[model samples]
Target: MSEIPPDLRYGDSHEWVRAEDDGTVVVGISDHAQGELGDMVFIELPEPGMNYNQGEACAVIESVKAASDIYAPLSGEIVQANGELEDSPELVNSDPYGEGWLFRMIPSDPAQIDGLMNAEAYAGQLARILHEGGPINT
Candidate 1:
């Protein structure tokens, strides 16, 4: 079973969001997602000042197997991106929920986050996907 951290919220698209103390939310591709993507080779992250709507494609991560888009879980203006990814894209595979975090954003409306799935709900989603046989693009 993949490790799903209890504190983060997840999107059906396999993105995870963690709220920070400074009103910014940290975003990343979940462990399940990294596993599906295989060995990550590169990432194209959004600019720090870019504004994105909920569900928008904010970045792209390419692995040995495929390229996948990373979506915004909520509408927000990007505040920062993990520049370390340029040099160490493998961090996504090594520490997906921590040092592998992709970006941080200041949400346009904090309440938008409430619509995202909690950890349990995401776990159920993952189970359903496994039962159905592998990742389903949404």
Candidate 2:
């Protein structure tokens, strides 16, 4: 089973969001997502200051197994991106929620994150998908 961090809000598409005290949110694919994708080989993240709508594809992560799009968890402008991933994409596989974080964005509405699945809900969703034999996509 993948680790679902209790502090982060999860998107149905398998992204996780952590609201920062500065009113920005750190975004990354869930551990479940990275596991499904396999060892990450490349990552293409949006430049800081780019705007996106909720659910829009904002970045791309390529793994040895497949390439997957990373969606925006909430509408906002990107404030920062993790530059280290460009040199060591394996960080996604090693520490998905920490050094592997893709970007930080100032949400148009921070409350939007509250609508996402909690850790428990996301875990159940993952379990259901696995039980149904559905392949875990990005």
Candidate 3:
């Protein structure tokens, strides 16, 4: 079974978001996403000072089989990125929602997060996608 953290919000695109107490949000690909992508070999993260709109592509994770884009779940200014991923991309495969997080951003509008699916909804969406035999985007 894929490990789904109960506190994070999820995008239809399979990215996970965890809001920090400091107002920055942590972003990452979910376990189901890493499973579908296979072994991640490389990750390209956004620069710390970059800004992105909601749903905009901001990074890339390359696996042995495919390259996947990582989108911003909400409009935000990137405050930090996981530089550790460059040297140890496998963290994504092992602990995706924890130490494997991709970046941190200060949301342009925190309310945008209310529009994303919670853990239960995301799990249902994942189940529905699997039932429909659709490709799981990372």
Which stretch of 10 consecutive residues in model 3 shows the poorest summed lDDT?
129-138
RMSD of model 1, in Å? 1.0
Kindly list the per-residue Cα lDDT of model 3 for residues 31-122, writing each as its tens digit: 99999998999999999889999989999999999998988999989999999999999999999988899999999999999999999999
The lDDT, on a scale of 0 to 1, for candidate 1 is 0.91
RMSD of 3: 0.7
Query: How many steric clashes does model 2 contain?
Result: 0
lDDT of 1 by residue, 1-138 (tens): 998988889987989999989999999988988988889999999999999999888899999998888888999899999999999999999999999999999999999878889899999999999998965562
Give the Cα-based TM-score of candidate 1 against the true structure: 0.97
Give each model's clash number: 0, 0, 0
The superposed Cα distance between candidate 2 and the true structure at residue 36, in angstroms, equals 0.8
